[model samples]
Target: MATIVETAVSAGSFTTLVAAVGAAGLVDTLNGEGPFTVFAPTDEAFAALPEGTVEGLLADIPTLTSILTFHVVPGAVHAADLTDGLKAATVNGAELTFDLTDGVKVNGATVVTADIVCDNGVIHVIDAVLLP
Candidate 1:
C-alpha cells in the first residue's frame, strides 16, 4: 500500500488538498511513520469555498498548515471507531466533534467516503473543509 500522500496523489480528486499539503511544507510529516486519521477534503470541497479563499489560504503558509493539520488526528482511527457525539483532537490541537445522525460527519463536514486505508494512516473523505 502507498503512503497517505501517495494514495492521495493517485486518487486524483484530492489535487487541491495535496497541493495545499505540499505548500504547507507538510509532505515529510504526513509521509512519516504515523497512524494518522486524515479527514481529507477533495478538490470539489476546496472549490466550494468563496472566491479567493483558496488562493488566500495558499498564500498564508502558517494558516494553511494549521487548517490542514486540523484535519488530521493521531492514531489509525477507522470508521468503526467513530461514534455519535464523539470528539477527536486534531494534530493542530483543535478538536472535531463527530455526528453519526446522517451517515457520518466530522465538525460540520459530511464524511462522503470513509476508511481509505493507507500505509501510514487512514483517510475519510469529507465533502466540506473543516476550519479551525
Candidate 2:
C-alpha cells in the first residue's frame, strides 16, 4: 500500500486537505510510520467554509496544524470496529464522537467513504471539516 500522502492523492477528493497539510508542514509527519486513522475532509467541505476561513487558518501555522491534526486519531480504526456511539481521541487532543446508527457521523461530519487503507494509516472520508 502507498503512504498517507499517496493514498490521499489517489483518492482525488482530498486536494484541499493535501494542500492544507503541505501548508501546515505536516506532510512528513503524516507520511511517517504511524497507525493513524484520519477523518479526511473532502475539498467540498473546505469550500463550504465561510469566506476567508480557509485562508485565515492557513496564515496561522499553529492553528492550521491543530485543525489538521484534529482529523487524525492514532491507530487504524476500520468501519467494522467503529461502534454506533463511539468517541475517539484525535491526534490534536480532541475527542471526536461518532454516530454510526444512521450511516456514519464523525463529530458533525458524515463519513462518506470508509476504510481507505494506507501504508501508515487509514482514511475515512468526511463531508465537513471539524473545528478544534
Using Cα atoms with residue i matched to residue i, what is each candidate's TM-score against the true structure? Answer: 0.98, 0.96
Q: What is the C-alpha lDDT of each candidate?
A: 0.95, 0.92
Among all windows of ten consecutive residues in candidate 1, which has the lowest summed lDDT? 99-108
Compute the lDDT of residue 99 as modeled in candidate 2: 91
Error of 1 at 80 (Å): 0.5
Per-residue lDDT tens digits of candidate 1, residues 1-132?
A: 999999999999999999999999999999989989999999999999999999999999999999999999999999999899999999999999999998998988999999999999999999998999
Per-residue CA lDDT of model 2 for 37-121, tens digit only, reads 9899999999999989999998999999999999999999999999977888999899999897789998879999999899998
Error of 2 at 7 (Å): 1.0
TM match of model 1 to true structure: 0.98
